[model samples]
Target: MTGPFGATSTTDDVLAGVTLTGKRILVTGVSAGLGVETARVLAAHGATVVGAARDLDKAKAATEVVRAQAAQGGSLELVALDLANLASVRACADGLVAAGKSFDLVIANAGVMACPKSFTADGFETQFGTNHLGHFVLVNRIAKLFAPGSRLVNLASSGHRFSDVNLDDPNFEHTAYTEFGAYGRSKTANVLFAVEFDRRHKAGGVRATAVHPGGIQTELGRHMTPEVTQAMIESINVANSAGGAPAFAWKTIPQGAATSVWAGVVAAADAVGGRYCEDCHVAEIVDGEGLRGGVRPYALDAENAKALWAKSEEMVAEAF
Candidate 1:
């Protein structure tokens, strides 16, 4: 469905004519890909952007690139954040909170994709720990830093269609681990986090939304081996064939960042909080294996979201 923007829209297009004077934003994973572009466009529009990355040196370099793109009155800075390590997450969040800074928008855009099985320092499966739980803890602890009308944008994925979250065994303590399965569960958790976070905080004028930035060639896919990549493409084609849906194509990096930039800054997005978005609009809810487009029903379920939140709280209690 068409909206103010379309699938080919870029961050600059979504943000055209919008002035972000005095706006304060935090964008994670600014070292490359959509995060860098997202930060760059926002900064160029006159916002103060804090670009978070695991490597300060890299982020400092990246921030220069973003700074170079900034228009008059725009500014960009770098912060260190390593989502996989709870201590790192705590230090980063604490530093910001201690600085008494408030954010108009916080984009949880950093994440890892399907990779060979591994665990975070906290003993969570790497994908679940880093992609979902890491952001979960960071956001919740810094919830107070969100100004009224602030937005939290979680970068979920259409690959969530790979599987529903298995909360009981989210860490794969019992079930066999598959890379994509873990990735899917984590992405689903991103949406569920938005659903529950929005429900709890919307009345206070804070909102959360999850976005599936259309696929683009980025470092996020560095873990994909040739064989795995081929299998993934084949699987998508097979599913599309079965569902009578056209195959999907990769988007340019700018186009890939469009929906996220829209969700974070568009006034219309208030009406779609707790929903999954793509192509700069709220996506439909669909069931089955087809990858054409749409969020899985389970991703937005209130109960599932609530349960996941509770479990997350337990998991991160000590750190928080």
Candidate 2:
């Protein structure tokens, strides 16, 4: 069912007539792009927003305008959080817990895209460690901070079409690593993480869902090279033709953020927890080569989710 919104819908559009008084939200990667817009809209609607970033100073400066536009009783604050560093994740979670803040929403919106081979301080692949494992450890450790009916919104991508999780060799220890392959595996992990997280915690009243926020030009693509860009475009065109699908489209920052804001605050989204959502609703599972839209069946595979959860726990060496 198509909702009342579309690709053109902005954060403000989805949040119209919505009052978020008494609600508290934590948005990671809020220093720029969609993250900043998401925080601004939520706070504008009366929600207390905690913006998390690697640089507290930069985050503060980036969000100064959002703070100025905050609704009465709404507020925005910055906290240090580097998803690539487990220590930073732990410290940030601990600080929030100490502050006695119970969150109504948690948006894991921070991520890196196609980049050179690298590893996090934890020695995990940079994309997987920062994008998936980082959020994995954060959510599990701070599980108690979410109030009943709270939503955990993970920002996944249609780029997940590039590959599924390589459980046996996720770090590319023996295999050749292409930039998009590593990035895709990390995104697929995001979807699976939400699936397993919801299965384990929904009984406690919290729900987790993953979202493909659509293709938007953002700083996240700063790492894209000319070769990678051309290859990506060619791949998408081939996929679209093979599947008889339309060409992919990009959204503005606000437009791209619509699904996240919808998933975070919409009751309809809570009802479909654990699902992969796109275009403001639960996405259809599709077959064939159209990497432009629809979710891969593997992304929502229950067994995959469970296995990923186990592996993630082992990697972090900490169980919550």
Candidate 3:
């Protein structure tokens, strides 16, 4: 309803006084950066968090950090996940199902950005494959385990403004791939995933949201080249100099995680489904800002979201 908790608001700020005792939250990409911060804050607020990472060792390290920061009786555990691989996603979900665990919140936060053109083991474009399809299947597979009143948040990005999904060639089979374009498509898919998921689940008391965590320097950029990173920095500096960047932008990890935490645990968000959020509140439609740092029309289009859902189902039919 209001602007996201201000750019400076940390996860701790948004989660203050929010008690999640006995609540089960599953957070992907929890080995580092905002994911780790999000898990730590949730656990500190009394949630039993299952932190999923691609690497068990990294997950262990992240759990240690969360455990150290946890409130007296809060808890954090780790599970292995690889969003790039369907087999891996299936294994992760199957493991959770086998453990008879259910979740109150599922944060689909793991993502790859601007990496070189690649493919998942199943031969789908790496970005679209990992960032979208994998999460799609994972969420659907675990949907039955999601309790009523549960929330799902996908970590979408302002980068989605660059491009919409190419329904004609989503797998890049017909056209040559570009890094940013693929990244944009993947991000757009993230929002679309939420859009369609809400349409199907809101009536069932399960809600979904997509969030653009304001820019924070995180490992998400590790795949970028030094030159590309420099160019991005210069562009941001120019924008800042020109008064384009938000005054309260460029968050610390804690700050970057605030919006997701708020969306996950706040009672105010109970009825707020299928919206793209930023800061700590629902985001406005971006006409001008969409090109800079907001959700694009195509990304949030309900029709397009449904279409993409159908396409994803076809692509991963066997896996699901």
RMSD values, in order shown = 1.8, 1.7, 2.4
Give the TM-score comparing model 2 with the true structure, all chains together.
Answer: 0.96
Per-residue accuracy of model 3 over 61-147 as CA lDDT, tens digit each: 766878987774679888889988899999999888888878899999899999899899888899999999999988998989999
TM-score of every model versus the real structure: 0.95, 0.96, 0.93
Worst 10 residues of 3 by lDDT: 286-295
Pairs clashing within candidate 1: none
Residue-level lDDT of model 2, residues 1-320, one tens digit each, is 22587667888888888999899999999988889999999999999999999977877888987898899678998888999999999999889888887999999999999889999999999999999999999888888899998989999999888899999998899989988899999999999999998988899889999998887888999998778777777888788777777776668999999999988887474655999888787888986554677899999999999999989988999976
The TM-score, computed over Cα atoms with residue i paired to residue i, of candidate 1 is 0.95
lDDT of each: 0.89, 0.88, 0.84
Better lDDT candidate (2, 3): 2
**What is candidate 1's CA lDDT for residue 260?**
91
- Screening candidate 3 with a backbone cut-off below 3 angstroms (N, C-alpha, C), the clashing residue pairs are 4-279, 4-280, 4-281, 5-280
Clashes of each: 0, 0, 4
lDDT of 1 by residue, 155-246 (tens): 99988887888878888989999988898999999999999999999999999999999878899999988787777777777877777767
Q: What local lDDT does model 1 show for residue 221?
A: 97
C-alpha RMSD (angstroms) for model 2:
1.7
